[model samples]
Target chain A: MKCDFCRETSVIHVRHTDKWFCEEHLVASVEKKVLETVQKTFMINRNDKVLVAASGGKDSTNLLHILHKNFPKVEALFIDEGIKNYRERSKSFIKKFCKKHKITLHTSSFKEEFGTTTDQIVKLDSTKTSPCSKCGVLRRYLINKKALELGADKLVTGHNLDDTCQDILMNIFQFNMEKLARTKSISPGFVQRIKPFRRVSERESMAYSIIKGFESNEGACPYVSESFRSLIREELNDLEFKFHGSKVNLQMIFDRLVPNLEKKVMKNRLNKCENCGGPTSRKVCKTCQILEQLK
Target chain B: MVTLEYPDGAKIKVEIEGSLLKVLVKSGENPEEIIVKKDGKMIAEDYELKKEDVVQIIKVGSKG
Candidate 1:
């Protein structure tokens, strides 16, 4: 089949638009949509100091590459979660890419920041809480601390459409309306976070990475399957498979309905954590609480 | 036999013919997270394949 735009053979059938794209067009299409997201959402400014969370996984790697191309002062932050067989390998790809492209790369870790690694957290978590939950809290804490230290104006994360949609759906299932509303709020000591790829699907990013010749298959986080998000992701993907553009449609509805409804929900006023001075709705932040539990 | 190539470098050879989704399910690969191609051109889940086809499967974002 030929691409909807050109004469080249179509390499991807975008079922949502019922359009097809060849390799070159696919690359262009993905980049165009991401840039459009940033512009339409007013996510970035030309002179802003942008810090991207680069995991060296396909999505992050692609995000980093695209941001570097568009912005002048884009740097990368990689938080080592201390996962055996995961973090060590993923770092290499980001490190190499950053070096080759001459982009400044900053890194921190759970061990250095919180006195423990994810591997240790998984073993020490007697409560049997999800490692992703623990790791996420700590990683996020470090990202904010580091981003503030770097004086970043905006912190960019590689959250694609699928991830955001899954998060919204999960929040809905939990009846956590406040949490959904909180996603748009900026807290003290946390750099403003942006998701330029929130409109881009994971599959499109994967295809973009490979087609652009920098795709890295660092494998899944070893503990990914155990998390509830994994289950949600699987269910959502299956739904998308059954109904083309289901993920995109859900996101469209969320973009339209959820935020409007969010205004009715009382916004949280976060206070500084007494223990760590981080922003939290409670007296202590989850990061401090999680570290205390591990200890 | 259709020669199936995976991103993990596993070459799977099987007598498979039918939609890509069916083949992925039978091969224990989740169609939801995979992109299939027949000779470098992306194929949809419903796209049909025949015997002797060289199919490449690219695993997308990692799932648990």
Candidate 2:
């Protein structure tokens, strides 16, 4: 159905409010709401530079596009994780999107920064640990470092509600207390990691991508074939369908518990890694350990 | 003085001076599960205390 607000909108759904919305209307709604949330939650000013972490996928691309339209001064950061076809396609999409949007794109690679990608690291030695962990760890380290280097006030991610809830379940299942403590609707860290699309669902993001004709690579990362996170994502999908408002419920739960949880999670945290002197709850930071393991 | 415990069977004594949040972060403690008490009454971390305010960090297990 065509959205009443915008004629270009295709998919329509009504919830919470009496207003019915098509894909365009929903995307616009999310964009507007996201801006309000950012403004309310963070000290975002006109002078503050935002670094949007782009994966060349629908969600990130659409987010960057919408954000650039709203804020007019946002740039993008793309990390090449060295997953054969996946990285290539994602990079291409990101480049095209940036070119179209006239936004500056900064590119970094695991191979360039760390002399390895998740693929190369996993191949160096066979272990039960999937490449996703390495990629995530490395990507996170680089993202924060790069954001700080670029002098960005905030690092925006494209994590939707589905991903957030799935992560909450994963942390719960694994008893990863440290991860759980900070996995709010908006994550907290040395650098502020904001998920403006936290309230938007994966399906809705997909619909928005389709309606907006935004470029997207819908394929799964090749290295994630053995990822436990993917398994948890599948399980969470069923739970989300059976339990309505799961995202909102989780957000509310986090809101009430985070302040306490943060104190608890960091209780065991060490001042600095003994090896690299980076922040950690252990003697050595995870990145330093991973790098050592790679060697 | 604050008593902080870890899952790995470790304990710490925290001296709350400036910001409780800064102290917690500096002590390598989780900012979420910290329990503060004053004369046996639970207090929020952000609450300012008089001289010699005793604080304790509580360890909470994750429900995996």
Candidate 3:
């Protein structure tokens, strides 16, 4: 089939927009969408240093590439969860990509910072809490600490539309309004976090990565299936398959709801964690609390 | 004839002058499980299709 804009054979058809594009147009379209999101959100300033949290996956890889291409000051931070096969494979890819792009890459590991790997922590857990729950808290804590130390003006993540929408649905299903409020695009007293691909879907990111010739690691973590998120993700996918545009509609509804929800529910003051000296809503941060349990 | 493109690079040709839903059904796609878009705008099931309209049929699902 011919591309909608040019004579090149079309490679992708975006159904939500009814647009067909060849390789060049598809890459341009993806980059254009990300740039539009960043501009619309006022996510970055001219002098700001953007620290991207990359996991060597398609979403983060595409994010790093796009942000580096557009922004003058962009670097990457990778969290080594030490999940055996996954961490090493992803790290190799990240190192190679960053080196090739001439972007400075920072590395932090759970074992080095917390004295235990995610795999170790999961094995030692007495509470039936999913490993993802613990790993997420630790990863966020470490990333925040590292970003501040690096004096970054903003933190960028590769959370695509699917991840954002799934989190929203999960929070609603669990009746966790405070968690939902925290999902707002901005929060005071924290490094301004931006998700430039919040409107882009996962499939699009993978396609973009391939089309752009990015060598990304596509392996899934072994513990991925243990999270409630995995369940929600599957259900959302099923719903979307049955109802086209369902995911995009869900995200649109979330974007409309988050601002008001933040005002109403995100009232918890940021308190300094007594142990780690990081900002948290509680006295001892969730990370500190988890560390205490692991000890 | 309207050409419908799937996610896996598969294309289906259908001859339908009615709504997008009719074309989707003719292409052997479950109308409920597919999203149809023409000219980069999502068209409802009742959206009319003209000759040579390139309808992109995206299955509503993501691996996140």
lDDT of each: 0.82, 0.68, 0.80
Can you list the residue pairs that collide in candidate 3?
A17-B40, A18-B40, A240-B60, A241-B60
In candidate 1, what are the lDDT values of residues B7-37, reduced to their tens digit? 6788997667887667777787766577777
Lowest lDDT block of 10, candidate 3 chain A: A9-18
Between candidates 1 and 2, which one is better according to DockQ? Answer: 1
* Candidate 1 local lDDT, A20-111, one digit each (tens): 77889989988999899999878899999999998888888888888899999899999898988888888898999899989999998887
What lDDT does model 1 reach?
0.82
What root-mean-square deviation over C-alphas does model 1 reach?
Answer: 2.2
Q: What DockQ number belongs to candidate 1?
A: 0.54
Q: How displaced is residue A218 in candidate 3, in Å? A: 0.7
Task: Tell me what fraction of the real C-alpha contacts between chains A and B each candidate also makes.
Answer: 0.60, 0.00, 0.02
lDDT of 3 by residue, A1-295 (tens): 5788999766555655567677788788889999999898788997899999998888888999999998999999999987988889889999999999999999999989989998898888999788888899899888888998899999989998878988898889999888888876455557878889988877667667766778877756788777888888777766765676888898888888888998898777777888877888888989899999977
Which docking class does model 1 fall in? medium
User: What would the TM-scores of all predictions be?
Assistant: 0.93, 0.74, 0.81
Sorted into a CAPRI-style docking class, model 3 comes out as incorrect
Regions more than 4 Å wrong, model 3: B1-64
Please report the candidate that would top TM-score against the real structure: 1
